[model samples]
Target: MAGLVDALGPILELMTWVGFVPGVPLLVWGLIIARRRCVWTRTTGEVYSAGGFTGFRWTDQDNVQRQTLVDADVARGLVAGNEVELHYDLCHPARWALGRPKHDNTVLILGWILTSVGILCTVGGFVLLLF
Candidate 1:
């Protein structure tokens, strides 16, 4: 058991790099995008269902019609021509989402967890090296 543990020490230390390298960047990018999404334009749209898929359609400020598929949760209880709320980027009308845009914490949480693990591993590695 001790021999196996000793053999894996260096490998575990190197694996920490895998988490640190991507975690910080993911957290930063998630924050930036979440912040930007907070300012998207809000409007009322209509839901539509076709063939086994559900989506919504709305007109942009330019009066151009736009449509995109929605997730099951968003499509629940909705039917064709049902009115729904939507959020969209003013600069890119095609970029839209159901409901008001808010900070999606999924990426942020994952990034934080990975980064914390990496930091702990690094600190422990250094402590072990010194002692």
Candidate 2:
């Protein structure tokens, strides 16, 4: 029992830290912030790297070329020399991610999944308490 609960530690911690009812909304809010705040610019970039770490290069607002390597999570599986859209902050272009966030947005998917599991645990915790 302790092992199982421990495996769910992160989810439990999210609820405990943010409160169960607000946890999912907080996640949703974060997603909304990402979508709204990130500057979506159409440009071509080269995706290179493998075995988990990947990177890409694109020009910023200042026309300064930029590349994200060893730190970009969405850089994998993208082919090289192919034109790709990139999403990044104008003030912080180095932190850019893949464009077309509607497709294969790993961060969003993981966030939703984590939020769901946290909600489930919150409900279970309440039930356990009531019993």
Candidate 3:
């Protein structure tokens, strides 16, 4: 029992780092996505094609007409001439999102939760090791 307990310590210690590994990167990626989508301009776009590569057209703030291609999932169940709500970047009108940006995104939320767990685990592990 004593030997087994000693062996488990190192394994448990290593596990404390698990959250930080994926958590940090995911948090950073989520922040980048949020930053890029910070100033999105919302508008209605008309679907021109609902085939494999969905195509839609919208007019930007400049009043110039523009068309772009997206995945079929973005315009699912929509046919040609159907109007869809979209969000476009202010600086880069060509870049867009299917709808409003979600405030609680999976990556960001998961990353934050995991990072908090990692911090608690690491601190608890150190305290145990020291004692």
The reply for model 1, stretches above 4 Å from the true place, is 1-5, 39-103
Residue 33, model 3, lDDT: 75
Compute each candidate's TM-score over C-alphas. 0.46, 0.38, 0.49
Q: Candidate 1, which ten residues in sequence have the lowest lDDT sum? A: 30-39
For 1-131, candidate 3 gives per-residue lDDT tens digits of 66765675676566667778888888998888777655777999998864456688999889999899877566577788889898888788887888676566788888887787778778766665654
Which regions of candidate 3 fall more than 4 Å away from where they truly are?
A: 1-11, 44-58, 67-86, 91-110, 127-131
Give the CA lDDT, 0 to 100, for residue 63 in model 1: 86
lDDT of 3 at 39: 74
lDDT per residue, candidate 1, 38-131, as tens digits? 3578889988888989998888888888988888886778888878888898877777876566656788888888788788878777766644
The TM-score of predicted model 2 comes to 0.38
Cα lDDT of model 2 by residue, 46-103, tens digit? 7666566667777777789888774544545566555677777675676655645343
What are the Cα lDDT values of the candidates? 0.79, 0.63, 0.78
Model 2 residue pairs with clashes? none
Instruction: State the local distance difference test value for candidate 3.
Output: 0.78
In model 3, the number of clashes is 0
- Model 1 lDDT, residue 116, Cα: 85
